[model samples]
Target: MNPKWLTRAGLCALLAIISLAASAAPAGPPRVAVTDLAYEERVSEYFRVVSASSKSSLRASGRESERDSDDAYSRRSSGSLNARSESNYSSTEGTYSYIDRGEMRKFTADIKGGLIKSGRFELVQGKPFTDTKHTEKLYDIIARIKQGMYPGADYVLFGSINSIEFRQEANPIDHTNTVSHTLSLELVGEFSLINTRNYAIKSSFSAMGTGQDVKLLTSQGGRVVLNRGKVVSEVSRSLGEDVARQVEEQLTGVSSAEERDNSYRPRGESVREEVIIFK
Candidate 1:
């Protein structure tokens, strides 16, 4: 119970508190809120062709005969002969057609669902907004953030469908008796991140995947079936994964979860500044 011993114990307790505070301080990984994750109707193309054939037959027959005679001395000569001809034939004709409605809906839904399942951030739903000249929606988003719809969110995520185009064309070669149908889905994604605190953009990125075409034949008296949902799902999943990876890299300077968790403050970086600059 000496006074000097008590002073030493107090000093030890203070040192422990300081160490705990230092350890508990946030190292990296900013708490982010992802807003506006709705499906934007982009270009989706789907086409299917079905073909059928019909056949007919024909037959024809014919016969002919001739006779002649021959004699000696000053007479003439003669002969006899018989002949027959017959023909049988068959013919076939085929028709080709297609339908492309349900595929579009399936594709759009697939993309929306895939992005939501990527586990990047807290996905929030907002009113629909088209990419056309519409500043009202943007302002509404800002107002919502200010009204505490999202608390402690550091950033807002917004994106647009720059283009969604599907090109479909089928060519039938008369000499080859073959029909080639090509279907392509091209999508472009334009994304921007805005700082919720200052309502300023943090980063902007764009990615596009095009020239994906599926070719099939429609000659063998059958229908070529394609699942539009599957194709869109794949493309959407790819786009979402790429976007998530890029965003993580820009925000945390790392591409993977492990790197994000183990990241430390750079030698001189005390505060991470928002890199998005408005023009």
Candidate 2:
């Protein structure tokens, strides 16, 4: 065989193998967009209350009467004197009250801050749906985008705070006015993934997270107390992250399944065999 012919044949075979490999290559990662989480209908401002106990004591009651002898000092200036009387009374009572921890505290938390572009998908920050009536805006935004847009979002994720609970418990440790209290905050959220084109929900799930703060109350000053507002924000952010993470995991799993399916296809086999032959 002519050496030049062999060289040409080898080049043609290599090109064909390269084309086959390209055809079998997995698709690029999907684009995902996240909307600003919506607040539930019954949502209200967050708050906390502080309370302490004290003792009250009252002195005993007393009555006294006094009379003076008129003739005892009758030498120089004898004068009539009226009798005098005095009375004292005392009473005690104990009461407990819940004082509102009255400093208006504020905190800002972004639940989706932990999400970033990562393996198998590109995360995109979309216009947040902050209003109660945000569905119209979201659908309109999706409608404006052209189909098959390169690197365009294939799915949209929506999340909302489903529940928020705040509670405080106080326990007295001993008689010396020593007390301990625990503050708990729980947040629950629901998340949904929708197909961008048809607006059909592909997946839905719920996640929850909790945060707690504890303090010991004492007559001794300078004991640190946890801020209730901060704890609520922290717990809310935690719950949001949990929900977002589950969505990411689901999307990643779907991508992996697709890759697995592709690997078992005949094109995949052809690519593998050609690469091995070339090697």
Candidate 3:
């Protein structure tokens, strides 16, 4: 064989081997960073404890100056206090937190686990968000992604609590004086998956989780405490899984996918929680 011909054949053989190896090797799955489940709560009911000057202050301030007589017999001392009639009270401020930031991770616990279990994508840790200005930043998926909240991730899964409610009721038993103290918790959330490189929304959906706790009280006046931890855990688990499943279905093409929809925007947001305080 000619030396030039052998050299060409050697190069061809090397190229073929490289091609074969590339074809046999499996491609890595897309990497995804599941963001913190952001949420905004509106004040459904709230109690404001305003401490103004005592009501007595108004009476004293409104009292007219009396003309004094030049005799001690005309003078009498009234049992009035030295309290100022002017309204002077500071606006009461209280620290409010529904759940710990660390515990908030529970909201997306099952989503992370489900993604791992499915073996469909590589999971990465999304960055922790700080409270800047307002809670709007918490659920701003686009802003978060642009801020590198999902570093080294090909996709980002953004979740936020849309609404959550707790309801309580008391009902009497059919044939007894016993009453049932029932507490029900329900939460709804929305999610969006976006391509980190292009910021294209790959998919979006909403999911809900609900739980209830009931106790039988012997008398109508009996008290009951609802199982908060158990209910929250149940809600988180169920909500996370539902979000994860929809994500999987949309990403893996198991169902009709919402692809390349450029006009998609994240959902609207609401404000603070409502709780009462008495002192």
Candidate 4:
């Protein structure tokens, strides 16, 4: 046993541990350019009609010729006539309009924040996509990256709404019944890994979420009035989690490597319209 040799060995071991620690420490979360999540305004062909019956007065006009009654027997029968009547139909239509884009923007930001906090990846905060009105393009991400928003991003994530629909059906018996309106949102996500040196897509993957029912409401008047923002928020949250999980699986090789040739696979079944209420 040589005490001097043991001390030297301990010093070397300490230096080696420090080096490993430095190498393992993350520089930061992965820089991601999430395109503005675009949404589509989808209209449903299904419609419901409600009818109500109420008592109301009606006016009628009549014309008579006095000469036609010349041979009348002078017998007049006094009776009342009942008639089925209808009034001018009046209707009002209502629907859920797109909520503030800020909600969705904040949602994605929070998702990124959560992923970073989980210590999964270093998240680089870049400008939020403000163009919520147009089809997403890869150039947008490249343009922002070139502009120094994301100086050194390792990947880019983008998504779009394939369709969003809400439908309601009224009960035949109850004319004034409440109809269930189910909100289904389909989101498609695409990921591209960057080389950082050449900024090329080293690897890419795509996933989709279909028939995801985010919210439900009762039809009011002739329209369904629900909080679209809230629905989008919930859907976005789920979409983010699902996409992150898929990406993680791809990175860790947990699931089958996404088919590069396919590039895209149907994520889930089309969401079926749900009946929240019969009336």
- What lDDT, from 0 to 1, does candidate 1 have? 0.57
Q: Hey, what RMSD does candidate 2 come out at?
A: 19.2
Clashing pairs in 2: none
Model 3 ranges with Cα > 4 A deviation? 1-12, 42-104, 134-139, 220-223, 252-279
- The segments of candidate 2 whose C-alpha lies over 4 angstroms from its true place after superposition are 1-19, 42-120, 130-151, 174-177, 221-224, 228-233, 248-279
Candidate 1, superposed: residue stretches over 4 Å from native: 1-12, 15-24, 37-135, 138-140, 171-176, 209-215, 248-279
For 60-135, candidate 3 gives per-residue lDDT tens digits of 3233345565663343345443554445675665544443221155577777876776566789988878765455
TM-score of each: 0.48, 0.48, 0.63, 0.45
Summed backbone clashes in each candidate are 7, 0, 1, 7
Order the numbered candidates by lDDT, best leading: 3, 2, 1, 4
lDDT tens digits by residue: candidate 2, 173-263? 8666777788998867677877887877777888887888888878775656778776777776776567655665575553354564543
Which digits, one per residue and each the tens of the lDDT, describe model 1 over residues 1-279? 899999999999999999999999866434455444333332445555555455555554555555555653343445555554545555544554432211122223333343344434444443333434543344355776777766766666655566677767777867775787666677776777777788887777886654444555756756765556555656666666666656657765666777754563333445556898899
Candidate No. with top lDDT: 3
Q: Tell me how candidate 3 scores on lDDT.
A: 0.73
How does model 2 fare in lDDT?
0.58
Q: Considering summed lDDT, which 10 consecutive residues are worst modelled in model 2?
A: 99-108
Provide the lowest-lDDT 10-residue window in model 1. 99-108
Candidate closest to the true structure, highest TM-score: 3
